[model samples]
Target: MAEPSKSSSPAEQPRWQSGTGLAVGMSLGTALGLTVLDNLAVGLSLGVAVGLGLDALQARGSSTAPPQAAPTTPGAV
Candidate 1:
């Protein structure tokens, strides 16, 4: 039987992209909240908290598999 493909699927993106997305979301949320509520400390704190939580969740979800080993050649020392 043919060996299965080792390539990662196109749908899977690097973990940093997800964290950056969460950071952007939090920044926007905080800006909106501050503009609407006139509170800097509350907005910043809430944004940081939400961003950290989302990053943690993303890390948890993506860590199921261990790192892959490098492929070896048949005759290389």
Candidate 2:
């Protein structure tokens, strides 16, 4: 039987790199503000603010996590 690989994959990218929350927040804020308020400037500003807020939150959450140990090969000293 073969052992499963322990290497990190692309899907394991850090939250900051992915920007998933920021993108969603910006899109939703802009869409709602524009359609309801009919103001592009206000809408975009709100969107950017929301995205930044989400990014900040993610950063804060990640900062408190314990550091990860470096990976080692099976036979390496």
Candidate 3:
């Protein structure tokens, strides 16, 4: 069996690049506003804010940091 590369999976890709959080949030917000809140402006704004927050959180986690050199002690090779 051939081993798959970790980078080859689409599921591993970061979602913030696609703005999925915002879209989902907006959709839910619109629905909620129409059905319960009865305020389109408030709902959309809240949705966008929530979506941005989620996107930022996801983007932060997805950021790639440079690899650090292994620490070596004076006696260690």
Candidate 4:
């Protein structure tokens, strides 16, 4: 019988494993600070920008590999 393939699949990098919390915190803080400073527009914009930026960064770290189902063999039932 032929040996099973041994090549390692690309490992998935953990999400939010980097400076994600800092980014989120900074964004929220900036938004809240701006709101307190009577700059609603800037606060909203900053909050949205931060959310999108974090989303992009997080997406950059994760893999797209589909979850693989176990292989079924004949007469195994």
List, residue by residue over 1-77, the lDDT tens digit for candidate 3.
33443442335665556688788789888888788899998889888888888777765665544444555567655
lDDT of 4 by residue, 1-77 (tens): 34453332223334445556456756785768676857766766676677667766565534443545567778879
Error of 2 at 69 (Å): 12
- As a whole number from 0 to 100, the lDDT of residue 66 in candidate 4 is 50
Q: Which parts of model 1 have CA positions greater than 4 angstroms off?
A: 1-18, 65-77
- RMSD, every candidate, angstroms: 7.5, 6.4, 7.0, 8.6
Please list all clashing residue pairs in model 3, or write none if there are none: none
Clash number for candidate 2:
0
Lowest lDDT block of 10, candidate 2: 1-10
Model 3 has an lDDT value of 0.71
Residue pairs in collision within model 4: none
| Model 4: lDDT of residue 26 | 65
Candidate 4 regions with alpha-carbon error over 4 angstroms: 1-36, 64-77
- Give Cα distance to truth, residue 57, candidate 1, Å: 0.6
Q: Which 10 consecutive positions of candidate 3 have the poorest summed lDDT? A: 1-10
Score residue 27 of candidate 4 by CA lDDT.
Answer: 70
